[model samples]
Target: MQRLLHSSAPLWASLDKAMLGKLRKKTGYTFSNCKKALEVCGNDIAKAEEWLHEQAKALGWAKANKLEGRATAQGLVGVASDSSCVAMVEVNCETDFVARNKTFRSLVERVAAACLNHGKTLPQDNLTKSFLSADQLKTVPCGKEGGPLADHVALAIGSVGENLSLRRCALLQAPPRSAVHLSGYTHPAENSLGVGPVLCGRYGALVAFKATLDSAPKTQILGRQLCQHIVGMCPERIGDPEKDSPNPDTDSESVLIFQEFLLDVNQTVGNVLEEHDASILDFVRFECGEAC
Candidate 1:
C-alpha cells in the first residue's frame, strides 16, 4: 500500500509527505485513508481533504446503519435558551465513556443550538411547543457553515466509532412581548464547550411561566428554581396543581406543581409560584437515555 501510494504521487513524494501530514491534521482521518486520498487526488491537499470527508461520511453512515439496532441507553441531555425560546435535545450512545468525550459533548451542544435556531423560525404568538424526530432533525442544517446535521453526526460517529443517536429534540417558545418568563436548567451541568449557549448533563428541563407582579430579577430567580425543581422532581405533566386533590395512594410528585420544591422543601412548587404571583405556562423535562 505504501509503495503504491508513493508510486501514484512519485513527483510529489517530498511534497506528499508534507501534504499527508497536513491532510491528517485537517481531516482527522486514519493514516491509510488520508494517504489514499492524497494518492487518489495526486497530492492535492484541498481535494484530498474533501475526499476524506466524503469517504468518512460514507463510512459513518455504513457504521450507523450496521449499529442501528444496538441499544443506546447512555448519553447526554443538552439545553440552550434565549430570552423567549429554549430547546432541549437528548443524544444517546452505547456507553458513558463516549458520552463524556469532548467530541460527543460538542455534538450534543451543536444539536441543541440547531434546535434553538430552528425554533426561532416558528411563530411565537403564545406558548408553543415543537418536537423533531431523529429523522427530521438530521435533515436540518447545522454548524457554522450550515451542513446537514446528519453529516455532522455521521462524521462524529466516524471518529467516535459508536452508534450515536439523536433520540429526540423539543423546543419551547414564548411570545417575545408577552409577560412569559423562560428558564432552563441542566442537571449536573457541564460547560464542556466553555463558551456556547448550550449546557449539557444527565438531565435537563425548560419551563415557561407568567408572573403578574414579581420583579423581573425575582422572576428570573423563580424561573430557574422551577426548572431545577422540574429536573429533580421528574414531573410527568404540569397538572393543575391548585385543583387536583392529593390522594395518599398515588404519587403527586409526578405532577409539577404538587411536588415539594427542591429549593425549599417547606413549600410545594405550587405554593412558591403562588407566593411569586406566577403561574406555570408549560414545562419540558428530559433524562438522558430515558425510555421513549
Candidate 2:
C-alpha cells in the first residue's frame, strides 16, 4: 500500500519529502490501506486523506489503533476583504518554519481573498466557489486552471517540502452602504526566536464597525485606536473585568476601556472614547493557539 501510494518516484524525487515520510511512518494500517486510499482519491493526496479519515471513522480504526495522540502545530493565518465583506483564516502546517515562510503566508492571503469573493463559509466545499465574485458569481472548476485557493495550498505543500493544511476560516458581511475594516499585527522579527516561537507569539485582532458618511470621524478614530491598543496591550477580553481581573473597578487592569492605552499609556481607551459618541458593533481577537 505504501509503495503504491508513493509509486510516482521521479515525480516526487526531492529532499524533505515530509508528506510521504509521515505516511510511511504511520503504523497500525497495512500498506494496502494506504494504496486503497490513494486509488480511491484518484492519486490526489488530500482527497485520499479525507477518504482515509472516513474509513478510520467507519471502521473504528483510529480508536482501535490508538493513533489520536498525533499533534498538528504548524500553519498560517490570513485576513481578506472584498467590497462587501471581510474574512479571516488559519491554515495549519506540519512545521512552524513552513508556517512562517513567505510562500505559505502568500497562500493564506490568497485563500482569505477567495473566501471574501465567494461568500463561502469556513471549511468550505467546492473549491470553485472561491472564484466567483459578487458581480460574476458562477460555478467553476476545482484546480489551478480555475484558481481555486485550496488547490493552491495543496500544490504549494507538494512543492514546498512541508505538510500544509487549511484548518479554519471565518467571513464577516456588512449590509449595503456599510464598510468593514480589518487590522493586523505581527511580532518583530528580532523578537521571533524561530518559527515555533514566532508562530506561538503572533497575535491578531479584527473589528467590524458599520458606519456611513454621516458617521462621526471621532467614532472611526476611536475604533482604530482601540484596535491599535489591543495590538500593543494584549487585552484578554472586550469588557469583562472578572476574566482578566487584578485591578477591578477604576484601578482594575481588566477593564477594556479603562486600561491604559498601549500606544500612549497616558490616556485610557475610555478617555479617548469620551470624545466620540460612536457605538461598537462587534470585535474579534485571535491568538495562535486559541480556538479556531
Candidate 3:
C-alpha cells in the first residue's frame, strides 16, 4: 500500500496540455515559464499565476539591471498635451528598430502622460515649467491605479530584450486664467499605435504664448509655426531683440526671436509674433539621446 501511494503521487502532480494552455492564456507568459511555475506551485493554478507575476517582475528587474550600462543613442521623443498643459519625455533604446516598436511607443506615450498629469497638479499659473530627471521620473505613478513608472519600464526592457532608459522629462502649463495658448509639434510626427493623442518622433517642441487681443485663430497658427521653427532651427535661448541687436555673423539662430521664420523666411520670428500680436511665454525643445 505504501508503494502504490508513492507511485500515484507522480500522476497527481503531472500538468497536462490543458492546464499548461490555461496558465499561458491567463498570464500571457511563455509556455515553458507557465509549466515551470505550475511545477513549482504543485499544480495549483492560483499559486502558479501569482508565481508567474513574481517571476516576471524579478526577471524584468534582473534584465533591466544587467543592461543598464549599455549606451543608448537611438530612441523616440513622445509628447502629450491638452489645453492647459503639455509634456515631453525622452526614452532611449539601443536601436531604431526598438524605438519604432509599438510597445516602446506606448511606453513613451504613457510616460509623457504621466509627466503632464504631474504638472497639472501644480499651481496652474502662467508658464509653469518643470523638469524631471530619470531618477525622479521613476518614482512617479504612471496611472490612476498603476504601479511606479520604473516597474513599467523594467517590464518593457525585459519584453524588448534590450536596455531601455527614461532619460528626461519636461512639462509646461498655462491655465485658462493665464490666457496662455500652448502648441506642441513633433518632427516626423507619427501617431502611436494603440495609443491616443500622443505623438512620437525623433524631435519635439512645445510653445506657450499669449496674444494682446482675443485672436485665437492667428495665435494658433503662429504658435504651431513657432514649434516647427524650434524643432528645425534648434534655438538655444529666447533672446530679446529690443535689448540686443541681431548680429548676422554670430550664432543668430541660437536666439528664438532673432531666427528667421521656418515657414516664411522673409520675416524673423519676432516680426511674425508682432504681426499676430502674440508674445511667447516659454518654450521647450527635445532631441532624442541628446546630452543628459
Query: Which numbered prediction scores highest in TM-score against the true structure?
Result: 1
Q: What lDDT does candidate 1 reach at residue 61?
A: 81
The candidate that achieves the highest lDDT relative to the unseen native structure = 3
What would the per-residue lDDT of candidate 2 be over residues 127-169, giving only the tens digit for each residue? 1112233222213122233544544554555444555555554
- In TM-score terms, candidate 2 sits at 0.53
Q: List the pairs of residues colliding in candidate 3.
A: none
Count clashing residue pairs in model 1: 0
Candidate 2 backbone collisions, by pair: 1-31, 74-93, 75-92, 75-93, 76-91, 247-252, 248-252
TM-score list, all predictions = 0.85, 0.53, 0.83
lDDT, model 1:
0.81
Off by over 4 Å in 2: 1-70, 120-148, 179-201, 210-224, 240-246, 249-252
Best-first order by TM-score: 1, 3, 2
Worst 10 residues of 3 by lDDT: 1-10
RMSD of 2: 11.8
Candidate 3: C-alpha lDDT? 0.82
Q: Candidate 3 lDDT, tens digit per residue, 1-292?
A: 0010112133424787798899889878776677777777888999998887666667788889999899888999988888898888898999999998877888888888888788788888557888999999999888763788898888788788899998998888887666788888889888766555788899999988877756667666677788999999998888887686676753455788888888988998888889877788889999987874
Q: For model 3, what is the error of residue 65's alpha carbon versus the real structure, in angstroms, after optimal superposition?
A: 1.5
